[model samples]
Target: MPLIRVESLTKIYSSTKEGFAGIREVSFEVNEGEVVGVIGRSGCGKTTLLRCIAGFESSDSGKILLDGKSVSRPGPDRFMIFQGLDQLFPWLSLRGNLIFAMKTVNKDANMKELQRKAEYYLELVGLSEWGDCYPYQLSGGMKQRAFLARALSVNPRLLLLDEPFGSLDALGRKAMQDLLLRLWGKTGTTIILVTHDIDECIRLSDRILVFTKGTLKFNLINPLPRPRMSEDPAYMDFYGKISRILEKDANLKWANAVLR
Candidate 1:
């Protein structure tokens, strides 16, 4: 069964600057343990769809189901990691933050077990040595890793990532992508990643959902094999196809606006 099912989800915002903003009739499903990537240009409601799924924003219409149950509000079963590194608590050390998150959901969990799990996830994210370090003391990439660890420590059934690596440098982004793959392999947690990077989406996602003008334009499965290398001809070919689709959609929107 699908772990997450978003049916005819719609949201609209009224504002003086950008009138009638938000997603419309968006729908998709995320299978258990599947990695789905949502991609589009800015102002395309990619993040809106993600926020709706995370329960951070209420949709004007439709439904979101998780594990066969309706999701009307935020819960421990779903955890979100945003693009900003400031999501971490500055006063708390990395390990402390993880422990605190664990306690929030599993209040009766034993301290020793929580600490053990914290350490395990820290090690998994390659931050074992920095567990005692404060968030302010770490680099941006390290801070993101800590955030990922903290989110995983809660044992969430679904992980929501919104351009989690967008702030990092090229090298840092690549490293985090590999780190994310390793962690996903270890945890088998279902993930919905919203990103503007097409190559990044192709590299990490099992399926890619293309959003344009507040609607789903395409839902496609990644046909490339594991350990996808951009240099490969097949990988480049697939990337070109996706890029063309995005470009075509953008042109169509521009033409429509001009006609109006």
Candidate 2:
């Protein structure tokens, strides 16, 4: 059975002048242990979809089912890592932040056991030595890594990521991508990643979903093998195809706006 099933999901913001539908009748399923990437331009409803699945946003119509149960509110079963590095508390050390998250969801968990899990996840993200460091003391990349560790420490059934590496420098982004791959390999966590970076999506996703104007435009499987290289002919070909699709969509959107 699919781990997550989003059926005809629609979320409209009435606050907007024209009542914008952030996501319009979107439907998709994510299988267990699958890494799905959502790619789209800004304001295209990628993040809205993730929020609906995470139960942070209520859908105007449609349903989100996880493990055959309807998702109604934010729960420990799903954890999100947003774009900002400010997710971590400045007053708390890295380890403390992770431990607190774990305890928040699993109140019956022993403090010592939570600490052990926190340390393990910290080391998994290559932040073992920085556990005692505050969020302010870490670099942007380090702060992101800590957030990832905290999210993973709870062993969530589904991980939702919204452009988690979008704010980093080129080098920092690359490092975080590699770190994420390694961590995913170890944890086998089902993930839904929303990103503007096409290369990053292709590199990390088992399947890619393209969104345009609050609608799903394409659903493509990644034919490339693991440890994908940019120089590979197949990789470049797939990249061009996706780029062209996005370009075409952009042009269409511009033309429609001009006509209106």
Candidate 3:
């Protein structure tokens, strides 16, 4: 059975005007230990779809079943790491931020166990020494690391990442992508990552779901081998195919913008 399933999922926002819809009939599934990417142009319901799976938004007409159980509210089984580092509490230290989730969910957690889990996750995200540091003292990447550590510390069965690296510059974003890939490999967590970056999607996902005009346009599976290189023949072929699809979807409007 799929780890998570979205069946005929649809969400519509309240509209004063007669003809505005949010998301219509978006559906997909992420199997156990699978990393899936949701790719689309901006305002195409990528983030909205992630929000629905995370239970941040209720669906208008469908069901979200995790391991065959219905999801109605936010739960620890599915954790979301949003696009902003501001999601982490500024006042809490990194360790405190991680421990807070444990304290909330595992009421019987003792100090030693909490510290052990926090340190384990911090080390997992390469932040072992920064546990006592506040969010303000860290750089943008460090703050993102803390956010990642906190999320991993929770040990959620499924992780929802909504453009988590969208704020970083080129190098920083690449590093975070590498880090995310490593974490996914080690933890074997089911993830649905929504990103505007097509290369990132192809590099990290087992499959890619293209969202367009509030619907799932297509699903592409990545059959390339591990440690994929940009120059690899198979990678280039898949990239070119996706580029053509996106280009057609763009209606040839950005003819000047080269996709490479």
TM-score versus the correct structure, for each prediction? 0.94, 0.94, 0.93
lDDT for each residue of candidate 1 in 77-121, tens digit (9 for 90 to 100): 999997664888789999999999999999899999999999999
Clashing pairs in 2: none
Error of 1 at 154 (Å): 0.5
lDDT assessment of candidate 3: 0.86
User: In model 3, what is the error at residue 128, expressed in angstroms?
Assistant: 1.1
RMSD of each: 2.8, 2.6, 3.2
Model 1 lowest lDDT segment of ten: 12-21
The candidate with the higher TM-score, 2 or 3, is 2
- Pairs that collide, model 3: none
Clashes of each: 0, 0, 0
Q: Model 1 TM-score?
A: 0.94
User: Model 2 residue 75 lDDT?
Assistant: 95
